[model samples]
Target: MSEPQYKRILLKISGEALAGEASRGLDFGVIGEVCEVIKECTQMGVQVGIVVGGGNFWRGVKDGAGRMERTRADHMGMMATTLNCLALADVLEQMGVEVRVQTAIEMRAIAEPYIRSRAIRHLEKGRVVIFGCGTGNPFFSTDTAAVLRAAEIDADIILLAKNIDGVYSADPNKDPNAVKYDFISYDDVLAQHLQVMDFTATSLSMDNKIPVLLFALKDPKNILRAVMGEQIGTIVKEEK
Candidate 1:
């Protein structure tokens, strides 16, 4: 098979991906599996940058305790991402892949603050950098952070490793016959109000002309396949 078209890619993984069938918290086995795939991609000469979400541990809007403010909940969510970042970094390191965790929020002792130049340098040295914290602020999702980081790092494409295999006209789980799009334009996504990512993230990617490939994370090999340009999922890009 021919290699993937991308030389550099940003992979956005939801915190939920780190969880096994349990539906909450970190699962080392799952993380280790993902790390192996990442190691393979790195070995294949593909530069990889990752942005991880904190939904497994926290979601600001979903908190029902009433005592927690939105910003406070979001802050906790950011910290949760740091924990996931550290875990991923450790696992990837054990896999013999150079990895770094950069946070949007200042957690000096645990990670380096998000610096575009430093991230770029790490990528140049063939190190995988995982970005944690959601834009270092509330009112933003990690999806937006992924797009921002991709643009900052000058990534060729954004790989959205989702729970589902690809973008669909409707929620496939709800509607069995929902059509899966093989390829789509960013505009089409926006126009159709598809939920591949949040509108903010989708708009940013469109504005920056970054293509996003959505694929399932259930198959660890999908990561390698994505980097190898296997066309395993929907590709969202600008229209020709």
Candidate 2:
């Protein structure tokens, strides 16, 4: 019931997370849990904008490895994101949360085209805005799109909901000795070549001075805990 540390946040969710244990397609149960947490954030008067990934359906680089042109493959990946946005929007709406979906690519039949001012207006009006398609360009990951949207909206912070608990010195799954960081500087992340995010996304966040809080999405309440300013994850920002 306390005031959240941030007034507005950009939440980046992995599509594979949405797929739950099946790891292949939409899992409404997991989506429902995530959406329930999102609803709670709205009830707390927090404005939310989301960028959901499309790895569950298609991974441009991995799936398009052989013969598909990179551009076409990425476009397919973008469409996959639209599927996720629509799925999230549907669930949120069913929960009585006003939702709007904006896509980087224009699809008049389904969603509004990405307009910076309009997207901000939607947030201000207490509507959840879901951004789909990765920057409307090929070769750019959804991570970059999330940061780009966060910067455009002037969000206080980005809540990155992933499978891992936080950033590790190395892949914790692969390396037992990998150390977890409660907080880290953007420069260190870059210098050490850590995979907190893709290089472009991390550099963009650093330049924009937008901090990213990375946490496991398994316990969705961690999203609320993060907004309440609890130290539950690895925070990446410029070191003062």
Candidate 3:
């Protein structure tokens, strides 16, 4: 097997991926498979930090639009992410993989508070650190939180494991003719208004000079393949 291309990575997973075809709740079968891949990455000695989204349970901006206060709705979304993280941590532990869940919003009984040095230390010790809660604030997204955590930990790259295989000119599910990009620049993504990460997340990654790899999570082994530098996804980075 080829050695891993990156020594450390920040993996961003959407909660909808965990929901599988149901797209609204936890699916242990999918979760198990994902954790299996995560375990393989760790066994390869690649340090990983994860940031998970909560779209399956709640979407603050969409669900709460005009129905409730934005702050209240966003807070619910944060909680949803924490729930997802706990689930991942549980499954990882069952697989004999040491895992730690750190929340942006403090929850002493359930998980540790977000601490950069501690998170890095956990990764160094071979523990998978799952970051929950979306930047501990309203309006900001899990995408931005992922970039924030990646920059904090000095990760070599961000692995975005999503339902879609890669970046498309348009939503592939909606537009059959949408073209897939094997590689793209962060500036092009922003200028074209592509649906990769939100503007904030993309800008943050560009500013930090961190590359992001977007690939489908359908085959959990793709995670391992990505670390092995397989050209199986759309890579977003600076051109020069």
Candidate 4:
């Protein structure tokens, strides 16, 4: 087997990825499959750090109660992310992989609080670190957290596991003729205002020169393929 392309990588998995078919909540089958892929990547010597989203359980903007402030709603969302992270860490541990859940917000009873140096040390020790709570602040999405963690850890790439296979000119689900690029420049993505990721995350990755690999998470093995540098999905980076 060939050496993996990335020595260290940060994987960004949306909460929706954990929801297999249901409209809400997690599907353990999907989580188990994903864990299997992560185990394979770890066995190949790829240092992996994951950041999970919370859309499956809650979305701050979707609540109509009007009782909670926006910041409070967002904090609830962050807690939801921690739940997903804990579940994922449990599954990975069952698969015999050493895993750690580090939350930005302190939840000592459940997991370790986020400490940049400590998280880095965990990765260096070959343990998969899962980051939750979206920078420990409201209004920032998990996508931004992925980029922040990637920069903090000096990661080679950001593996964006999404529902779609790659970034398209338009929403492929809505447009039949949407064009998908095998590779794209960050400037092009920004110019097109593509929804591959939020502006903050995109700009940070671009500035740091960390390529973002956008691929579908449905195919669990794609995670391993991406770390191996297989041409399986769209890759966004600086134009050379």
RMSD of candidates 1 onward, in order = 1.3, 0.7, 0.8, 1.2
For every model shown, the clashing-pair count is 2, 0, 0, 0
lDDT of 4 by residue, 1-240 (tens): 999999999999999989988947999999999999999999988999999999999987566148789888989999899989999999999999999899999989999999989998999899999999989988788899999999998999999998889999999899999999999999999999999899989998999999999999989999999988899889999996
For lDDT, the strongest prediction is: 3
Predicted candidate 2: what Cα RMSD to the true structure?
0.7
Q: What is the lDDT of residue 107 in candidate 3?
A: 98
Better of 1 and 2 by TM-score: 2
Error of 2 at 163 (Å): 0.7
TM-score-best of 3 and 4: 3
Residue pairs with backbone atoms closer than 3 Å in model 1 (clashes): 4-228, 4-229
Output the lDDT of residue 220, model 2: 89
lDDT of each: 0.90, 0.95, 0.96, 0.92
Q: TM-score for all predictions?
A: 0.96, 0.99, 0.98, 0.97
Task: List candidate 3 segments past 4 Å from native.
Answer: none
Q: By lDDT, rank the candidates, best first.
A: 3, 2, 4, 1
Candidate 1's error at 234, in angstroms? 0.8
